[model samples]
Target: MKFAVIVFPGSNCDIDMFHAIKDELGEDVSYVWHDETSLEGFDAILLPGGFSYGDYLRSGAIARFSPIMKAVEEAAAAGKPILGVCNGFQVLLEAGLLPGAMRRNSKLTFICKQTELEVKQGDTMFTQSYEEGESITIPVAHGDGNYYCDEETLKNLQANNQIVFTYKEDINGSIANIAGITNKKGNVLGMMPHPERAVDELLGSADGLKLFQSIVKHWREQHAITS
Candidate 1:
């Protein structure tokens, strides 16, 4: 599978994402700078975490206007798979690729540690390897990771199975403990945790590899029949 990792100014995790996809998954991966307007020959695009644009205006507010985001939005609209982690998640919300806005952590502190995430919806390609209600440890580091959406929107998201991941414990005061969500079509996913950090047992755990593997496996399955 070919993967593209988007990098904006101040993005620190792009290399980690690159290594996770290329070295760990043994997949073809490339970095797409924020100024680039095209995403050529890539099946999946990832927006890895970090403070984009120095988080000046807001976590992802300014980064949303970057040129590459237009291409990312188009790709996502066309049913291509896209994953956003940390500030990437913030960008998705700012870009309207996903619903809800991130707020300061309930305690107004920067949280950085390995936390457990509960798989709420496993039918999506991102979480298919795990069963619903299963918990997996993934590292989360952010100051504005608390997710908030209006009550009606939250209800709708639940009704549509758009809520994909929730905190296993009430670590952040995210509305409904939501840690991640997907678009209504399930093609775009945005989560706060650092799945790339959990890909290797040497770093900590290998539980996050299932997410990358699941996407590749699904792509292969679809391509096998089409080819």
Candidate 2:
């Protein structure tokens, strides 16, 4: 699979994400600068976490206006799989590719540690390797990870099985303890955890690899039948 990792100014995790996909997953991956307006032949696009644009204004607020995001938005609309992590998730919300908004953590502090997350829905390409209700530990680092949405939208998300991951212990006080969510079409996924950081046993956790593996499997299945 050909994967494109978007890189914006102040994006610190793009290299980690690139290594995870290229070195760990052994896939074809490339780094695309934020100024690039074309997606070309990439099979998947990843928006890795970090303080984009130095977190100016709001996290991901400035990065959302980058030229590459227009192509990302268009690809997502066309049903291409897109995964956004941490600040990337914030960018998705700002670009209206995902629902809800992120606010300062309820604790008003930057949290950085391994967090337990429950797989709320496993049907997504991002979480199919996890069983529903299964608990997995992944690392999180952020200050504005509190996810918020109106009651009706929240209800709709739950009803449609759009909620993907939820904190097992309310780490950031996200609404409904949601840690991640998917678009109605299931092509776009956004979450505030750093899955790339947990992809290796050397990192003290391998739970995050399942997410990338799931996507690879999904892509293979799609290609196999078509081929």
Candidate 3:
């Protein structure tokens, strides 16, 4: 499946995402600038981590207005897989594509380290390669990674099985240790961990590669059905 790695100004992890998809995952991937208006041919959309617009107003706050986001929204509405990592997660929240909001880390510090995460549910497109309750290591780097949703939203997320991954420990003060979550439709995923960075064992882990593989597998299945 072909993928588009959306690049906004000051985005640093776009190349990492590209490398993970093209080199490691053996998929067709290309960098799409933020201002572009079309995403007609891509099978999936990836929003990589970085301080877009220098994180001036807020993490992902400015980048949320990028022209590409409209196309991203259309993709999501069309049931195309969309994965947003780190600041990309923040952008997703800002765009209201997924529920919840991010806040400053409880300790008020920038954290950079590998975090152990548990697969909350493995049936979704993004986690199909993983088993439920399985543990995997992925690196996270961010200062405002705390995730909060109202009690009603949390209950709905739980009821719908939208929560995808949770930290083994409270790494960033996110409610219920949520490390990642999918939209109600189960197509869009937003997470704080840098899965692209961990796609290579040489980088200390290859656990993240399963995520990309899962996406590809899902796409193939869907395509086969529709075609």
Q: What would the per-residue lDDT of candidate 1 be over residues 132-183, giving only the tens digit for each residue?
A: 7888999999999999999999999999999988997888799999999999
lDDT of every model, 2 decimals: 0.93, 0.93, 0.95
Model 2: lowest-lDDT 10 consecutive positions: 218-227
Q: Which runs of model 1 end up more than 4 angstroms from their true locations?
A: none
Candidate 3, after superposition: displacement of residue 116 in Å?
A: 0.2
The digit string of per-residue lDDT tens for model 3 on 1-227 reads 89999999999999999999999999999999999999999999999999999988888999999999999999999999999999999999999999999999999999999999999999999999999999999999999999999999999999999999999999779999999999999999999999998998899999999999999999998879653
Residue range 1-227, candidate 2, lDDT tens digits: 99999999999899999999988889999999999999989999999999999999999999999999999989998888999999999999999999899999999989999999998888888888889888998999999999999999999899989999888888878999999999999989999888899999999798999999989989998889653
The reply for model 2, stretches above 4 Å from the true place, is: 225-227
Error of 3 at 189 (Å): 0.1
Give each model a TM-score.
0.98, 0.98, 0.98
